[model samples]
Target: MITALSHPFFLHALLAGTAIALASGLVGYFLVLRAQTFTGDTLGHVAFTGAMAALAGGYDLRLGLFAATIGVALLLGALGRRGRPDDVVIGTLFSWILGLGTFFLTLYTTHRSSTQGNAGITVLFGSIYGLDATQTTTAVLIAAGITTAVLLLARPLLFASLDEAVAAARGVPATALGLGFLALAGACAAEVTQAVGSLLLLGLLAAPAGTAIRLTDRPYRALGLSAALAVLDLWAGLALSAQVPVLPPSFSIMAVTATCYAAAHLVGP
Candidate 1:
């Protein structure tokens, strides 16, 4: 395990995964509080479509993933200002994005040669081992920005999440705060997609936070627990993957996360 840390790829994975886990844990607390796990899951699919579209257009995949997910988050927020998001609206957007994803995948396949075939798979399942120093730096910067934004908005956001009517009565910008948080969540989802892939990102984003909330009613303690558990999940997963070279790190990470969540349900307060 110690020897694995000496390898460059493992180091990059460690740094990138840690950054991603921290941001995800923080944002995920509010995501569950706001009852937006479905929104986060939807964004993952949107990310897949966006990445495929980018690949088809020969553009950087992150640009498309972030742009599309953030754009949709804003749209969802704008449409749901008066109340909770309508299931019909979410379903519509979900269908539209899935259709677009299929179209983009088809287009990419038609235009690109066999050498580019793995791009879609990479987008779907992630390619964390392929991350370089530059990408790791970018992930860290993005995570820092998101975490800072979350902290700055923590009190007001918490107020809004727990009781929106009261928050609004108290002059909190509930709508703006909600929108801002969703946008930040979208960015977090995009960054996480690079590590855990779009399909499995919900586990990384939600599991640790969910477990923490189950174990603790105090908000601050829950936040701390969430971040801690997320880091543990990431590190343990990486260590397992190192031991079993045949297995993918993302799979290992998600497995650990799921296991933790299950255990929390059984043993947590």
Candidate 2:
């Protein structure tokens, strides 16, 4: 374990993973609290589609990733009542996004597969260990930006999530906060896609937040605890994968996350 720290790849994974986990924890807590877990899940499909679109268009994957997720998030806000994305809005978009993803996948596989065959796979399952120095730095910066934005919006967002009607009545700008949070969540989903891939994005986002919520009824405490648990899950998963090279880091990390969530259910309030 200590030996892995000296390696550049492991160090990069650790740093980037920690930053992503922090943002996921913060944003994910609100996602769960607001009953917006489905939105987060839908964004995973959006992430995959976006990446495929980028690949098909020969653009940078991040360009497609962020543009698609953020664009759809804003669209969801626009389509829903008071900027709060409801089940109907999310469900309607979900299948369309998946179909679009399929179209892009066909384009990529048919044309660019010879050159970038694994690109789609990378977006779906992640390639954290494959990150180079520049990618790692970029991931960390994006995660930091996301974390900062979520923190700034945390309080009002909390109020809005808990009770949109009351929050708007109290002049809390519920609509704007909801829109802002969805956008933040979109960005967070895009960032998480890089670390854990879209397949397990919800696990990283939900499990820690779910565990934290189970452990405490205090909102702020659960928020912080969510972030802490996510970081620990990332660290433990990475360490385990490092010790046992046969294990995939994403699977290991999510396994730890699942275990913690289950433990929370067993031992928590």
Candidate 3:
């Protein structure tokens, strides 16, 4: 295990995965508190469509997905402010984009180069072994930004989440908090897609936080435990997958997270 950390690829992958897990847990805690669990699944699928378009258009898939995800996040925030049910819109939009993805996927299938097709798979299922130094650095930067923002706004965000009506009355700017959290979550989803793929992003994103929240009520403890569990789930999954060679890393990671959540639920209030 110690030697594994020294290997270049393993080191980079570990770095990227750790940062991605931290950000996911932080943002996801707020997401659970705010009742935005659906946003994770929704933004993840949106990334899928953006990645497909990027594949067809010759752009960087991550950037394309990030841009599209941010746009969707902002739009959902606006819709929520206007009293629309964002999840309903998101649910409808998910199928629409997925349909578009399938159509383009079929279009690409006829003559798509294998390299381009592999990019599509990367978006769908992630490629941890493929992470490079630059990508790892980017993940770290994003994680740092997320941590800073969440720390600064945690109280207001929490206040709004626990009691929105009271928070709104207390000048907590609940709508702004909601939009901010959504935007943060969108960016975190984009980062997580780097490690776990869009399909299982929610599992990694929501599970740790959900479990942590159930185990504790204090803000700091909840966020800290969530991040720690996320790191455990992904890193253990990575190591186990490397050793076992039966299950895929992405699914294995999610399984670990789901098990944690289930354990927390079983020991419930």
Q: Per-candidate RMSD vs. true structure?
A: 1.2, 1.5, 1.8
Q: What is the TM-score of each candidate against the true structure?
A: 0.97, 0.96, 0.93
Q: Write the per-residue lDDT of candidate 3 for residues 89-139, one digit (tens) a residue.
A: 779877898888877666665556665556667788987768889888988
Instruction: Please tell me which model should have the higher TM-score, number 1 or number 2.
Output: 1
lDDT of 2 by residue, 80-195 (tens): 76555568868987889989998998899899868766777888989789888999899899999999998888888888888889988999999888888889999999999999
Error of 1 at 20 (Å): 0.8
Mark the 10 consecutive residues where model 2 has the least summed lDDT. Answer: 80-89
For model 3, state the Cα shift of residue 191 in Å: 0.5
lDDT of 2: 0.91
The candidate maximizing TM-score is 1
Per-residue lDDT over 19-71 for candidate 1, one digit per residue giving the tens place of the 0 to 100 score: 98999999998998888999999889999998999888989889999998898
Quantify all predictions' global Cα lDDT against the true fold: 0.91, 0.91, 0.83
Q: What is the model-wide C-alpha lDDT for candidate 1?
A: 0.91
- Model 2 TM-score (2 dp): 0.96
